[model samples]
Target: MSRTLQSGYHRPRMLRHVGRFSPVRIQSMHYQSGRHIRLLLQPGRSLYDALVRPLQAIGVTSASTTILGGHFDHLEYCVAPPDPSGKAVIAYSSPIDAGASFMVFGNATLGKDMEGRPLVHCHASVRVEDGSVKGGHIVPQASIIGATPISVLVTALEGFELRQAFDDETNIPLLKPFKES
Candidate 1:
């Protein structure tokens, strides 16, 4: 904890994870020149499909995306809190239904899962119908887009693939870039 001498205010320390720390903290990859796409997320489609299908058609399977603000018919998200079990440092909580929410801003990553399926990892700040603002990991498959199209900026990763692999330190499947075999 840290204390302010004059004000006598004590600040709690940041929580540490229970798992063994990995030597490689940031597993990132870069490309020579990213292919940028200004995509308009089609209405009436799940966020997952809206992102995956069109990009797949363009041969872009790996990329980082920024989802601009837009409305959703329904939305569900999960927050990461301390794991109740001692298996990992943190775990995603059960999905929280944010009914008829407006996504204020979001960043999403596109990669291939262990089974070679498209996986979208998205986090967003949203405004619910009740006017409360919240943020968490967005469930793209469950969140349906509203009538209007949502704008997204996509930076396609090429020359290498983003694949999910098991990480020993975190004991989780994480997306990492790998050169084409």
Candidate 2:
């Protein structure tokens, strides 16, 4: 069943996860300071490479980045819906192409995957080629930057690193802060 507002706006249905809910909904850590970097997303590169390569070159593997409004030659995204297989609360839908789109805005968290590779978790609102605006979890690896450069404001996390770890509460992997080893 879908949720609809009185105004006729449709909202996604909430799913019941197959795990115990943690009492601590907000898991966070404090940092002394973060180094801010103004980055330019290079044209003709996948969003993942454009955001990861430059930051990695400067020794910034963990950060919170704000991607300014920009255009993309190609873009894809996924929405989270109830997991039909019941593995978890929700699973990402297959990539939905938003051909030659405009990214209205986005926020991305930089971290390490389970294999210690750079992982970018991004969510954004975009205007698809059809002129309909949609929002979802961005498929960075599939999205290609446009001909012009896109700007990003990055806050590099220091003294600690973000790493993906198994979360028993959600029965899925999630990014968590860990002391730099």
- Per TM-score, the best of the predicted structures is 2
Q: Give me the overall lDDT of model 1.
A: 0.91
lDDT of each: 0.91, 0.94
Q: Candidate 1, residues 8-123: lDDT per residue as tens digits?
A: 66886764554566787776667788899999999999999999999999998999999999999999999998778877778899999999999999999999999999999999
Q: Please identify model 2 stretches exceeding 4 Å from their true place.
A: 1-16
Please give the range of 10 consecutive residues that has the lowest summed lDDT in model 1. Answer: 12-21
RMSD of candidates 1 onward, in order: 3.1, 3.3
Which is the leading candidate under lDDT?
A: 2
Worst-scoring 10-residue span by lDDT in model 2 = 1-10
Instruction: Itemize residue pairs with steric clashes in candidate 2.
Output: none
Residue 63, model 2: lDDT of 97
Model 1 stretches with alpha carbons more than 4 Å out: 1-21
RMSD after Cα superposition, model 2: 3.3
